[model samples]
Target: MMSFNATLRLAACLSGALFVNAACADQLDDIKKAGKIRIAVAMGTPLFSYLDEKLQPIGSDVETAALLAKDLGVQFEMVSVTNAARIPTLQANKADIVVADLSITPEREKVIDFSRPYAALTIIVAAPKGTVVKDYADLNGKKVGLTRATVNDTMTTQLAKGAEIQRYEDDATLITSVVTGQVDAFSSTPSNLGEVMKRAPQKNWERKFDQKDFLLGIALNKEQPRLKAWINTWVEAKLKDGTLGAIYKKYHGRDLPANVVQL
Candidate 1:
């Protein structure tokens, strides 16, 4: 009943649709078929992801990533990245997912999908006890250091208006800057400041003020609906089983917050 040219056109349309569907196939299946999962980790971030004495990667994120791969029955590949490279590495397909300490923010959500809160971080302004930085106003004209592209950087940039903000590429560099007197103060987590204190106990570094507490999540490309859903379910299971809490306590010396575990 159909004319020859019309039949050809219909066939072409169907073929095009099939090609598009194949091109947009679920990434999770691809990962499974590949027999490995590449996870992006921002190393040098103590308590999150960092190198061990043997120069092997070991930390909360590293362990979490390994667990994910184990659950998936795949090999684990660690893609080391700097703080600023976490999202970009995922976008570039250099990593399948990011287990780095990625904070959930509206701006970041626009570009990547995130699992439910699996952990939390509290940002604070830390300075030598003698520095007298009790509030944002106190940072005026003082040099403040923070790792670039972190929540600390965002909070300090937004609130510490008059402070001279110095950005470091990584946590180690920021800590070194503080130790060498390159910064008057720095924005970081309490655990990070504790590391700095260990290096310079006489300075008696203390938190000047709490900036904000953020919910950290695992990140992946926005298009992977199946992977995102799976990660969410996995996170919930880990939280309920106390697996995540144990990992947090092992490194952070404290249990995960009730709100984070209850999420």
Candidate 2:
């Protein structure tokens, strides 16, 4: 029963909406046109992202993000985020990509897409040498500090039965808890535990056990397939050329695993 004019008007409105959606979906083209790429980096995570003596961000992730922008011929813009904020920042479209040490997990894949892994990390439980924490069973009744929403937290929460789990917002705070003796033990990457050990060597902090070896992938919104594909290809190229391995070794003092680079 609609008149010709009314039908035409409805059609025109729908057409405009579709055009807008298409434009919004083309993030790859948008990034190229804008000449800038915003990457989310989580600060306070040592050897990944952290502040230097000059209060400037420096780490493997920071350098990797810069390398990505340079390779793309775009200006690099870092969007500082906490581990808990990385996915939310990408989901909100505040960043073009997340270059933080984001572990690839099934729960995360349901919400966002991940490029092939460009790095890897080992999750671990650490306590003073006197603590005698040989395994998860040893954590019973102990207070374990962890950075909230990280792979370390996930593994510890699922495995460290009967232990009181304390979550911190970021790595620095978790390290602080360990140094202040607020936490009897903590879960984090080996590098992060090393940072703690340096701050309190008198306590003889040492890794108790390894929990999991997680691959780090670049995260982006699920809608940006083009961007994701480009990232995957870039990661492969970087891996083959040894650029990523060099960066990892520069901070971590070891080469990337053969299996990881071959992947």
The estimated TM-scores of all candidates read: 0.90, 0.90
lDDT of 1 by residue, 80-163 (tens): 999999999999999999999999999999888789999998999999888888899999999999999998898889998999
- What local distance difference test score does each model get? 0.87, 0.88
Looking at model 2, the pairs that clash are none
Residue 105 alpha-carbon offset, candidate 2, angstroms: 0.6
Which residue window of length 10 is worst by lDDT in model 2? 1-10
How displaced is residue 121 in candidate 1, in Å?
A: 0.6
TM-score of 2: 0.90
Q: After superposition, how far is residue 81 of candidate 1 from its true place, in Å?
A: 0.2
- lDDT of candidate 2 over 8-86, digit per residue (tens): 4445444676544444345788999999999999999999999999999999999999999999999999999999999
- Candidate 2 Cα outliers beyond 4 Å, as residue runs: 1-25
**Candidate 1 residue pairs in backbone clash:** none
